[model samples]
Target: MLRAAFLASTLVFSVVPVTAPPPVDSAVDCDYYCDDRDPSLPLSARRSPHRPGTSTPPAPAAVVCNRYCDARDPALAPSNRLAQTVVVAGRQVSLRFDDTDAMGWGAIAGAVQPGDEVWLDRSFDAGVSWGAGSRLGDTAVPPGFGDWRTMMFNVDDWAGLGVGLLRACGRPAGSSTIACTSWYRTTWNAWDRRTAAATALMQRYNLSTGLFDTTGWWNSANALNAVIDNIRLTGMTGYRYAIARTYDLNRSAWQGDFINDYNDDVAWWGLTWLAAYDLTGDSRYLATAKAGADHIFRFWDSVCGGGIWWSSSKNYKNAIANSLYVQLNAALHNRILGDTVYLQRALAGWTWFLNSRMINSSGLVNDGLTSTCANNNRTPWSYNQGVPLAALVELHRATGDPSLLTKARALADASTTSAFLNPGGILFDDGGGGDVPSFKGIYVRGLAALNRALPDRPYTSYLRRQADTAHARDRSSADSYDQPWAGPFQRSDAARQHSAVDLMNAAG
Candidate 1:
């Protein structure tokens, strides 16, 4: 279903004009000015005489600059321009950075007017916070001017320790509302960011426990799967040791063989092992996957008509478990030679899942069924839309059914284009902590599977857009990534890192 038809109660994705409201204006109007004061002076030392007292200035840090503050506009070079965003009424805010000079500036064009104002917002902490609105290089459009720009400012802090995030912001004359473009990283390099993210993720790996630290059991399975895919996709052999290390160490830790009460958990590990087997052609990985699949199938019963229970407690039947069940079984059928048992099980699982009412009217699958086997109509997470695509692709491979690809494409198209799922062309998730952080990775991993199986390879551009945005905006200096792939890096952990890694792999 499209997000508009079935919006989640929490975590709504809307494209508001402004990401953050401007700080409250002081009672007295103040004139912003650019003075002869050294740009290297601390911001507090260089504040304008009429600056508002109520506005809490950014921490005292030298405003390093490479060129004269009001020198020629960097946008004139064209190649120095990094990114741009439309604020309102076709007004484009461009972020321009000159690598040689280590300076950046903001420019506004396209429907510019005399009263329009342009300025730069610089943040040392990846745009989490910046000085009280448009403090640096604030400029107003003059009569007959076609475009306007802010004065150049340093792209880094005084210490040059971290790359700063800069965005162009503007307001038309007489309009109280202010709009800003999305943040752009000063040191923007997609390949470098991907490598750094993958390397940093391995640093969080716990060699002793055989799992990525700072995440849970199922999350580790997904993380390991991402690492495996990264190796398989990029042919990076440095982290290959993690494949056997995780399996050997964790295999005996939980239930002695990657089996637990949660069917989804077992299925995740099963899929992880399947990826490992595919990468290395190790029979042990295949055997372990088969064992895990067998254990998950044990939860299948007559309850909810036919689908397997979510856990041993049998409290509910959810989309994730059943979707993973179908994918795992169908994948096994394609892998094992002359395996009719798994093939029949996969077919039966798909038939039952298709008949179930979990899939809503909009082609999106809800969380699960209610107590009476009706559609629960819960939040249709990105992952919920994902695994089914992988399942259908596997089913198509096993039976050579053309209709399976048709169904998979519909779900993929709905998800990649949906406003709620992929707002502003970027995948949206609240990242409300815990397992939610890992959900996007699982979604994209499944999407990549479908992309590989298709002859047209349709989802390539969509996946690449996601990878590029995350690499540019959602990453930290240490190469860790946060939940939101768009911007304003909040916090990072193993789950978030692995999810970003999954995107990098898929994009390639």
Candidate 2:
């Protein structure tokens, strides 16, 4: 998503055609050339104007070829290219490709100086190694230059047998540090991207602790839920170990069975465990969910006329805590057999929630109730809008009430179309470095649940838009996503990743 406005005037140069290297032996040269038709051979070997070993060396000509081109090929048109840039060492390093010509190169700009080096890496594998063509088109900025680029090289194999991956790498003038952009594969479809995103999410998992590193406790539950959903949706079982790992390691944390003072936190874990039970049929996960649900219902009181308190202190009644309470109880009722008690509690909770006036005129749920038990009218956080949709969906399933789905649809329609909540059709929430980072994903998860229950799947385009934006713009070169789904990826952590992964799961 990095725009062309950032690119400096491109430099063009011609290089002397050298003798072609010996044909690579795939069997013995597998370390450098993994396949028989490696694309790493110098341009002279493929289509140089002066054929190799010619007695009369033809004059060096501006490199020009289609499908297979030398570095800095004049035929590489700028208009037919796809590019993505990342900030590295305080400079812009971009990987650019002209798919029409099956050519790619690297660029560096911003405070450019002599010794600032940029290059392109080609990999027959998925970036596991650079293979033979790595460092292709490597170039450095000259003195007083504002930017520089490497020569063009073919992105496809020699015979168009396969499309390899490419990335832009750079190093500052005086820094030993080297950084590279994420690998770009031209053939990757939506499912391939989702798989990559899920793989990146799992990389943050702490196998020993059964928690995703760089995120909080409750956020880990959401992360686990996203992982489970990814597994179910994609049928990829590689990360299934996380299910038992999280349950076994964290089941005893904080007063046993994921029970904590914050009712919402406990509810997140409860729902996550329920999802695990559904995925793996683990009775322990279901039992833990039941335990957490029972514990959360204990916090519901006459206070605020009947909604769960945010914490054990019972100082405030909030929309999130209560909404989660409704969702957990309703979901438990639907899952458990002979569950009159859970059903009644869910219905009672729903009745009180409807009368609570937390849902505003715009159909978005507000943050919480005021001290006077009226609507607090706090900023309508995305999660506040989300959990309730899930609650309504579960309630509808338990009671077969058509009205529940109607209410869910209204909330879904509002949130999906809201100017602030979903600007330009992509979900937006700054997350302010706290629990906010996890909020948008929860909303999308709810929207997806409601979408599944509806016959029409009205939110299909909406979900796909969010996922596509995140994949194209919000992701870092490492495939990690930050909060904003639009662009300019700032940073990434477990919370941000799970939120994006949830979107991927929904859309996939």
Best by TM-score: 2
Candidate 1, residues 42-109: lDDT per residue as tens digits? Answer: 45433221212222223425455434332346655334755555566667666677655556777888
Which whole-number lDDT from 0 to 100 does residue 163 have in model 2?
27
Query: What are the TM-scores, per candidate, against the unseen true structure?
Result: 0.63, 0.67
Q: Supply candidate 1's per-residue lDDT for 286.
A: 83
Off by over 4 Å in 1: 1-193
- Tens digits of lDDT, candidate 2, 1-508: 0111111111211111222224322121123211122134333222111112223212112233445556656344553454577776578887777655657778898877799989876654223344455567778898877878887776545332232457777888777566666666442222376666766676566545677655667788899999899888888776788899778877776668988667888899999999999999988989999999889888888977888887776777888888888899999998999899888888888899889999999988888888899998888999999999999999999999999999889988988889989777678874464367889899999999999999999999999988888877777544667878886676566778899889888887
What are the C-alpha RMSDs, in order, of all predicted structures? Answer: 15.8, 17.2
Q: Please give the distance, in angstroms, between residue 501's alpha carbon in candidate 1 and its true position after superposition.
A: 0.7
Residue 442 Cα positional deviation in candidate 1, in Å, after optimal superposition: 1.0
- Residue-level error in angstroms, candidate 1, position 205: 0.2
**Worst 10-residue lDDT window, candidate 2:** 1-10
